[model samples]
Target: MNHEITELKFSVRFSDCDEYSRLKLSRLFQFTEEAALADAERNGYGLWNMMKAGVGCAITRMKLRLNHFAPLLGENLTVTTWAKENYKDKVIYKDYIIRDGQGNIMVEGTSSWLLVDLKTGKALPPSASPYPIPIIKEEALPEKLDILPIGFFPKKVDQVQGKNTDIDINHHVNHCRYVDWVLDALTKEEMKERGVRSIQLNYIHQVPLHEKVDILRFKDSKHHAVFFGMNAEDMKGNPLKARCHFQARVGFGE
Candidate 1:
């Protein structure tokens, strides 16, 4: 009665690609999320179901390893996702993989999520779920590194407000939008010159609609970049004073 793994097929569209025609990293996240949602829905623990039970899921961290170059527009891709059997510290883990039509792996990722009481906004244990969640023993991409911290990155790259379009069913900015905000911190030339090899993000707090956020970036190394999203008004003069919304680290290929 439970589908331990879920797969979805997709075709890269112009909308899903960057100006150079490669698949956008944010779109890749979206595809992965769609597969996860499909799996949950099939298992009877979908968004609405969880909400009706007074709890909702929120992603806490994500790490993705990419191929040498992103997939091109018009390419056919298949995304697969599954929940790991191990649930610890009130957090659930999910794994994802994306392959091209030729079955070449394009991306491998793993994400951590927590369940929250919708009414109180407090984190809940996995046992709070109304349905018996099924899990797969396979680990698509095992997490190893500690999540990136919100360092005091001096360069403030951009500022943005959580728009209506950025809001998701959970009434918070969608995870993919956070991906976009981080990637946007990089210059087009830098992105093209240094193709992304890996991406890691830690979602510390959710931003509601119309909330202003400050985007900061640090080119910490020749092949690495770090970013932080903080409350714009709350930042004051010290980054430490602001509530960090997310932290991201991007590794670039040579």
Candidate 2:
């Protein structure tokens, strides 16, 4: 609790695994989020404190690299996360590592977050927080995740409406649900043929509950695909008019 970094232990449950018994990417996201919240709470920037201060933290981007062998169901994992020392005013960088019981790295990730005013939803500087969480210099991924670019006519593969389960305390669709949507856009056969090697997400806007999201995808190559989540009207054949909720890049392996 006194350290800048926080580590928590978790056991992969049935719900956390996929058909292969390997941990789902979305579940891994949830675990990392839990670890992050724990770190913030211990550092005095918990939800109640932030709310009292009229500010809330929102994640803007995340990039994750998965090991060849993902964490399996029932495996014990240690999730460690820390906030990076801020050189900028408006954004915070955070890094994470998930290790198995055998001390092997299962997944590594980095994320960017912004402190926003609760009333106006405008981003605030780090100086505005009720408590300044201690930060470390360590970086999980030195390179920043880029914004995914799509072609002119990216195909609309599927559509999904935000459900109660997709909503979080922030009253919008949780970030992990977007991961699910991205994966769902691909077929089981495609996933089995091309295993997911890495994923990067850029969350552009909050998705309100019950809002229908159109999943559009551009397969750059046999091993890579970029996806965008937009509103129904936004996909009326114009990329320029698309009200993008999020953009993502999914990399696959042989």
Candidate 1 regions off by >4 Å?
A: 1-3, 150-153
Candidates in order, TM-scores: namely: 0.94, 0.94
Clashing pairs in 1: none
Q: Rate the local accuracy (lDDT) of all candidates.
A: 0.85, 0.86
lDDT of 2 by residue, 142-234 (tens): 866667666655788999988998999999999998999999988898677678889899999889998888888875776788898998766
lDDT of 2 at 224: 80
- The C-alpha RMSD in Å for every predicted model, in order, reads 1.7, 1.7
lDDT of 1 by residue, 151-194 (tens): 55468899989998999887889999988888888888778988
Task: Report, for all candidates in order, the number of backbone clashes.
Answer: 0, 0
